[model samples]
Target: MNPILEIQQLTHTYSAGTPFQRTAVEGVDLSVMPGECVGIIGHTGSGKSTLIQHFNGLLKPTSGHVLVDGRDIWAKGSDIRAVRFRVGLVFQYPEYQLFEETVAQDIAFGPKNMGLAADEVARRVRDASAVVGLDESLLSQSPFALSGGQKRRAAIAGVMAMEPDVLVLDEPSAGLDPRGRQEMMAMLGRYRQQRGATVILVSHSMEEIAANVDRVIVMNQSKVFMDGAPREVFSHVAELEAVGLDVPQSARIAALLRDRGLAVGEDVYTVAALARRLLALKGGGGVC
Candidate 1:
């Protein structure tokens, strides 16, 4: 299968030709396949945010190409606006970007901008709201009146309404209560399952990534450090820790158990999975 999004030797530098010149992303290459879920983990300055901004042309590459469906987004006469619509980006604190008078108006903004008719736009707003777990009654109220979590969901609904082929979210669960964060992840899972769209998430939480993503990409020193399945990437505890990144808690605990001869495999990255392995070991009277 072809990649829905591709980054080739991508680089982005801030304040070029000035005293403050610095490259946030340097010589990075990546590909995101259709209907796949990817998680990226990095420290504060690992260039994760800068790299994702190029996915939808929010920022142009300084020296490389970003392609969507085999077409260069930066090519002459390329429809960047179309790219934005296809690869919808929900930035961090997207709620702060909402300015429409009502929730429904805010959610309808993207599809309406896409030139869809009123009926289709309304349908999208309805469906998107339902997907994000927003109440139909709240649609009539002002966005500013909603709670933080509600506003977050409404803002996400706006982007989801566009029905993008690829969904790129930065910290979709940031600053939410545990229940709210769980609901947000559940919403994303349902959206991907229902639409078969490629989803890319940049998150700080290793546990969330371990449980949710099919592929994990670890960034370090403004470059791609590791890329693999969650279990594979997190298994490199020493390398990840060397770069000031932490493996998932379950993986760390599993590693500790393995050191004492529990025979717990490296595939364990979740508490439930680790517990099952331990239970099976005890059941069969394997060396603990």
Candidate 2:
């Protein structure tokens, strides 16, 4: 399948041509296939955020190009506004973007900006609210009146209402509690399953990436370090650790068990999967 988004030989520099000039990303090539979920991982300052900002024209590349649906996003006279509508971006701590007086208005913000008719905007608001599990009753209340998790959902609903072909989230669950994080992930999964939208997530948490993504892309020193299936990437624990990124907890524990002479499993990143293997080892009379 053809990719929905492509980044070719992309490079970006922040604070250019001054004493603060610094290269943020360099020579990165990335592609996201239709209906695929790709997780991006990197250490602090690895340029993950800077790299994704180029996808929808939020940040134009210093060199190279970003193509969406086979067209250069930065092409002369290209409708960047339309490209943004097609590629929704949920920034880290999206709740900070919610500014409307009420939840309904907050969720309606995107469709309203698109100049969609009121009835169409209402329909979209309802559809997005369902995806994010926001209640219709709460729509009448001020967005700021909601709890932090609810505020986050409201912010997400704002973006989801656009029904973008591609959804990019930068640490969407950054500050949520464990239950909230699980709920957010479940919502994202359901959103993908229902809409078949291409999703890209930038997260530093190895466990979150392992559990949620079909493919993993690792970044180090502003370059693509590795790109593969979750199991394949997790198997290279030492290399990841060397880059200041850890393998998933289950993978670490599995490695420890293997070193102790138990044939548990390799690249085991999910708790449930590792639990099953550990239980089998115990039941089979193997020493723990």
lDDT tens digits by residue: candidate 2, 1-288: 788999999999988899999888999998899999999999889999999899889998999999999899999989999999999999999999898999999899999999999999999999999999998999999999999999999999999999998999999989887898899999999889889998899987888999999999999999999999998998888888887789999988887888888887675778888999989888998896
RMSD of each predicted structure: 0.8, 1.3
Whole-model Cα lDDT per candidate?
A: 0.94, 0.91
lDDT string, candidate 1, 1-288, tens digits = 999999999999999999999999999999999999999999998999999999999999999999999999999999999999999999999999999999999999999999999999999999999999999999999999999999999999999999998999999999998888889899999899889998999999998999899999999988999999998998999999999999999999999988898888999998789989989999999886
Which segments of candidate 2 are over 4 A away from where they belong?
A: none
Model 1 regions more than 4 Å off = none
Could you tell me which 10 consecutive residues in candidate 2 have the lowest summed lDDT? 264-273
Provide the global lDDT of candidate 1 against the true structure: 0.94
Alpha carbon lDDT at 98, candidate 2: 90
Question: Which residue pairs does candidate 2 place in steric collision?
Answer: none
